[model samples]
Target: MTAHSRDTPQFYLTAPSPCPYLKGQFERKVFTHLVGENAAHLNDLLTHGGFRRSQTIAYRPACESCRACVSVRVRVDDFVWTKAFRRNRAINADLVGADVGANPTSEQYSLFRAYLDHRHSDGGMADMTVLDYASMVEDSHVRTRLTEYRRRGPDTAINGRGAGPLHAVALVDRLSDGLSLVYSFYDPEQRDRGLGTHVILDHVQRAKALGLPYLYLGYWVSGSNKMDYKRRFRPQEHLSPIGWTLLND
Candidate 1:
């Protein structure tokens, strides 16, 4: 049921399911639909409250005894590039991200499918079809964009956005407070290059360019090895009941 403004978010606990991040652990979530004209504003407030958006729904982990999921945001302007981070920047130097229309493409689907198969075979999205992927990208009611990542094509200068093969893609939401990384995936075979962290670093620069203070990296599950890299983005803020608290370096 819908509630009025100023009402605390109605929390719904999900039935037990296999945890996608930590094996042997069960997972649950508290969620609500993010519709209506206030969708964007609601998204901002919920984000600040440690909830993340997926299409029209916003959710936060509400597992019975798990405190693994923690909300994370990077201080874009103050982010100091480390030696490893700098090396990654040089490695994918030719890669450029272009914010394009939220429409899905066959190439994007192919990459997405491969990423799911290789990286998340047992996850919730293992069986998502092209139609589902399209809906995920285009079914948003807030400010959203698809940041297509590609190796700089020859005429990238003229086109502004590259026009060739897509190596990776991120569905992101642009908010008044910061850039939310809704979802992202890359070629799993390129794991050697650390494409995942590169995308986040790239978005931090993008956030800085837009004069936004933070890059909302979404939830970081403490027990999830895949999410541990989030800690590398120095000078970040993690939401706490007290307030947006600074994380220790």
Candidate 2:
């Protein structure tokens, strides 16, 4: 009999399912559990290899017929600040994000529920209950944090914390090279504010401030309208057969 070390990751494959991003296409994934002491290091390596962390599992697309999912990471040092991105920043100038522990709350759950209901009602996570949402935020083996965005308060400048109602939330992982955005949700009613784009922009600044070289944005599926916004963050790297290739266009 042979014993496997808890830190030794073993890969598994999921049964094919309907692709969420594209119509009439099936999707499959190869995954490994990130557990024990080496989880964070393993996560960083796998992320560089194009895997995404969901809970304690790191997975990447392995569809037999499609190769549209491309891993993308923004080059924090050379990030482009376009007119639209500047406008988005200005629009969210009154808001601030405070890093909090990866613990789920009723308030966060309410906003998450509303976001799913309004933005992705037909998606896979639409039926997620509070317990499921809690697991999503807290069931992680590596270093993770939750950034809660809210309107600026009087003490924001002094304390660097926000106040009032929650506007958005970002679940992020701290990797060796960069920050990987696991999930994010925002108030759907505040569409004009472009909270989604604002969140990404904020993460770019945060990563740069922390001296991290990249900000992993997960997989960008070509021809998926849901992923088109990712391309706007210029000077990004796309994982390819050879390695991480620069993508300026």
Candidate 3:
């Protein structure tokens, strides 16, 4: 038997379970633990290879008969802003995002719970307690940041952090090539402000400012109402068997 280095990731396959995005279908995943000194580099490679990070695990869908979950990354330079996007941006212009450390706070937990209760009541993470949420944010071996969004106030620029109640939050990892958005939540009642859309727009601009080329938006599953919003961000590249290909329409 060939010996493997301790740093070499050992992949595992999950048993088939009901698909989260698609109805009447099952899903499987090929995953590996991101740990040790090589974790960050491994995460980068796996992300580039269409895997997503959850805590310290990097995983990608490996269903036997379905290929519904398509990995997508927005080309920051080539992004085309439309009328609706502009309107949404204008609506959220009062928001200021602070790129803070990945230390979970009680305020963040409160917002997370509110978001889950209002938005994802029946989803997998609906019952996650404050500690579970903390683990999700703090138990990562890769470079991560929690971008806290709040309504801009007089002291926002001076302190480099927003003031007042938190409006939205984005948990992201900084990569050599781009910013991968791990998870995000917002004040559900402020749907009219399009907080969700604004978060992506803000990240697109942030990526451009940081000289990053892509903004990874996790997986886009077709026919899933929950994932339909991802289609609006255009000039994105979809990962396929051949490689990442441009999606114009």
Tens digits of lDDT, candidate 1, 40-122: 88898888889899898899988987888889999998998999999999998888888887889888999999999998898
List runs of model 2 lying over 4 Å from the truth: none
The lDDT leader among the candidates is 2
> Which pairs, if any, clash in model 3?
none
Give lDDT tens digits, candidate 3, residues 136-220.
Answer: 9999999999999988889987997878999999999999999999999999988799898999999999999999999999999
Model 1: residue 119 alpha-carbon error in angstroms: 1.0
lDDT of 3 at 56: 92
True-vs-predicted CA distance for residue 236, candidate 1, Å: 1.0
Candidate 2 versus truth, CA RMSD in Å, comes to: 0.9
Q: Report RMSD (Å) for each prediction in the order shown.
A: 2.3, 0.9, 1.2
C-alpha lDDT of candidate 2 relative to the true structure: 0.95
Where is model 1 more than 4 Å wrong at Cα? 1-11
Better of 1 and 3 by TM-score: 3
Evaluate candidate 1 by giving its C-alpha RMSD to the native, one decimal: 2.3
lDDT of 2 by residue, 89-188 (tens): 9999999999988989999999999999999999999999999999998898899999999999999999889999899999999998899999999999
